[model samples]
Target: MCNKHLMVVLIILAFDLAVATDSGLETTQAGGGLENRPQRDVSCRNHQEYPHDNICCLSCPAGSYVKSACTSAHERGTCENCDFDTYTEHDNGLLQCLKCTKCRPDQEIVARCTNTQNTECQCKAGRFCAPDQACEICKKCTICKDDEVKVRNCTTISNTECKRQLSTSSNKSGAVAAVLVLIAGSTVIVAFLKRKKKFVGEQDSQNPSEMEKVVVDSGSGLSDEEMQNKLNGRLYDSPLLEQAQAVGQQALANKEKETKQGNSFTSTAHSSPASLPTLPSAPLPAPYPHPRPVSPSHPNTRDDDLPRKKLVPLNGDKSLTDCFSYFEEVDVHFHNRFFRRIGLNDNAIKNRENLQPEDRVHQLLNVWLEKVGMEASINDLIAALLHLNQRLSAENIIAKAISEGHFEYEGKQPRDESQL
Candidate 1:
């Protein structure tokens, strides 16, 4: 029995040993199968550095063209020189050399084509490309207009530039216009002055005795009122003055009769023919007040006693309105002279030609206030205007209006005295 147990244990040990040896052999065979598996070759170089047909080949050198492919590894292709107008900038494996670019009609070759570079183009002297980037064709340069001038001449890379011809032409035209206006104005003024002088000479010749009498009376000791009355009586034979004198005499007689009646009422009444009444001598009527000259030291005082003349609307159909209307009625040249005397600037004077009558009046008033340093009364302003007219010509409506006191008031009742 002991022998039998020992033999059984030995047989079991041999079976376990056999199983371990078989597992080790199977693992070795599996590892050897994995080691024998095939892998694809991944060492093929890029075509740009090493081109290939059946094997890899070297690239062509710079400044050369590839004419044929290599048949073996580590070898270059058949290389050749580029044609005259052709180029090859890099080691390209191309079958043919590149053709050079041709310049357009408006372009010129800046750099000629060579083995290593292409041609470069630029615009000609008088032409330029419309779009500068990679431009295929060039366009003609811009031409300046008649009223324009060239600022920059055209170049290979840039277009022509221009600027307007305004400064010289505008300034010259304005100066010429101003000069012509001044010359024409001066000519008109000279002619007007000569005509006025001739008229004055004729008037003096016709009224020599009257002028001499005035000179004689001025030296006399007569008061201004008496002198004026005497002058008026000698100068005019109008019925208005005579009628005014008769009315004054009638008023004086009525006052005297009232005074005599009052004395009789106060004293005892007597009914005798010789003691009844005595007629008071009628007093002479006072002369109408003459316009006072404007005193330089007291300009405001000139219009204090004068009646205020009512202003008429500029659009009114009445013969007279403001002083500006009188200026317009005279002549355009006379009006311009008046504006100059009032110290209006050139712009304002020029603008006056286009203004309406009312606008002109306001403008004149403003200018007068600025120059005279004071507000102008209607009478004083009109008197100054009339005075200006007298300086220009002898046949002045304003002067006659002032002398005859025709411009007293705008409404019905005319005043007796002439102001300013």
Candidate 2:
């Protein structure tokens, strides 16, 4: 029985060895099959290649598309040109090119679509669009108000920008304040001067003997008899006498001017002075060196019942030009007639009609200055306004001219000149 058991055990061992060898052969066959089979899709260099059939194929170039994918690894694909109105903007592995963008009705084409680029568009003039936001539609540009000024015009990327105009009312108020201050200062100065004069007058009114003794005491190199002669004649300068003399001189000048005007009118009516060829009369002396002061009680202080303020320019042509803005106060209805009087032609005036009223006034005044050359004067413009019956405008302009220091009222000769 033991011998039988040993043979059985040997048989069993041989059977187990055969089962082990068979299992080993099956495992080796399965490993070999796995090694020979295709792998799963692997990672690709995205810029250079794309995956197809579990392999990486080289990508097509710009302006073209992949008509057929590469069958092998690391190989180029079959590429075809992009169709019209379509684009492939970069090296791509796409089935077909993308459709080009269509600009809206409000937009203008900046660049047309090409194989490698898409269309570019922008809003037309008088319109705008923001680039950062989706441009579903363009927007209308803004218009500035009458009191506002244009800072920048509208463009495709930016809307119109405006700035509020500086108020002319403020300027007028400031000018008025300056005038008040000046008037107040003048009043103070005049009061001080009057007080000083009063003191002198009181001293002058002393007893005659006292006055004579004081004059003798003075260190003047003259005899008492000569000094007495001076006191008797009141040779000391008198303000009242000087003022009366000035009034008389001004009246004489006006009478002379009127007489000349009358003679010129009468002569012209009878016959042309140029044609008559008469001998030239003596040149009239220059009118009184200063203008007459305005006083309702004084008959010679006015011209034709119109209050006159003599305006002497501070800077010649510059003063005239500086006063141009004052003309804006002129009545709108009288603009054409007023400028025409200043020698502006219909065309010259019409050319500036589109400008704002103030701007038109300024521009046309410059044109007038150019035409009149150095002979251009604010006085002439003022006279023209007066002729047009724009008396209020003329007055306002004159006041502005004087208050702004472009001109000064030549009311009196300097004190030193009067003394001489």
Candidate 3:
């Protein structure tokens, strides 16, 4: 039974080996057929199609042109350099090189063309290219406004840039307005000063007695007895009444003496010329000094022919300073006018006038202190006085007052009137 089993196994193994040999023979035959059969040329499929020597072939690379075709299939063609101004961007089988692009009128060549590349173009100067628009054509730059200034000039790649003119007209207008205001202010000040001066002059010229008469007339509704009582009281207390009384006494004595003299002269005249005492004749009066010599041609020369009076300096004795000192003893109203004449404001004078007469000087000093600050000094006061063209007497009064330390000051000194 073992021998029979062994024989069957041997038969099964031989059959299996024969089958495997047949499969191997079939695979080898197939492989041999594939290797021996004519292979398809894949070179033409992978590369650009080109005709060479009546057969297909690979085309030439960039930067060069085909000079001649290859002699066989799947071979490269003979290539040569492209001419200047001509180009081919890719591997081509073209018979001739392509012509390079020309720059437009508004464009310029930035880079020259090569066999492997085309020409590069840019906008010309004073022009620009917009990326949003077709770059085939360039546009002109925009102009700036008349009132605008150029912040950046136009360039081939950028448009013009501008900015508005700043502060020119506004500054000019401001300066003009300031000048006009100054002129108007000065005119108003001058007019006020003139009017005040005229009013003060009129007040100064009126007699105190006349002013009293006007006052009494305004109160005319009083009874006669009341009026007489008021006049008696005023006459006893008034200095003007004392002066009038003294004048009346002197006039009565002169009249009595004149009457006695007249009677004596008549009696002497009756006694005859021989009785009159002989008197020495007085020497002839001396010829007048500084007699103006009349011109021969001016036969009708008179005393009026003398030269006109010479103009004096403003600071001389004849100027307003001589009159300004008179205000010291005058009424408060006159003092107010004096302050205004010297450049103090009316409101300040009014305030000062409201104070007691003894305190008026202190008030004036305070006003000056406010205007000039703490730097008010003797020198500064002198400068102000000189600017006003005051006389020596007025200057002395101020100097004395300052020396006595009647007022205090600090800070910067006062400037001249022109600077003010």
Top candidate, metric lDDT: 2
Model 3 residue pairs with clashes: 374-409, 374-410, 375-410
C-alpha displacement of 251 in model 2, angstroms?
34
Against the true structure, candidate 3 reaches a TM-score of 0.28
Model 3: residues with Cα > 4 Å off, grouped in runs: 1-56, 67-74, 146-155, 161-420
For residues 255-342, what per-residue lDDT tens digits would candidate 3 score against the true structure?
A: 6765777868658758876654433122222322322233435534422232322212233322322333322443443455445544
Question: Which scores greater on TM-score, model 2 or model 3?
Answer: 2
Which one wins on TM-score?
Answer: 2
Clashing pairs in 2: none
**Candidate 1: clashing pairs of residues:** none
lDDT of each: 0.56, 0.70, 0.55
TM-score of 2: 0.36
Lowest-sum lDDT 10-residue window in model 1: 207-216
Instruction: Give each prediction's root-mean-square deviation over alpha carbons.
Output: 28.9, 21.8, 30.2
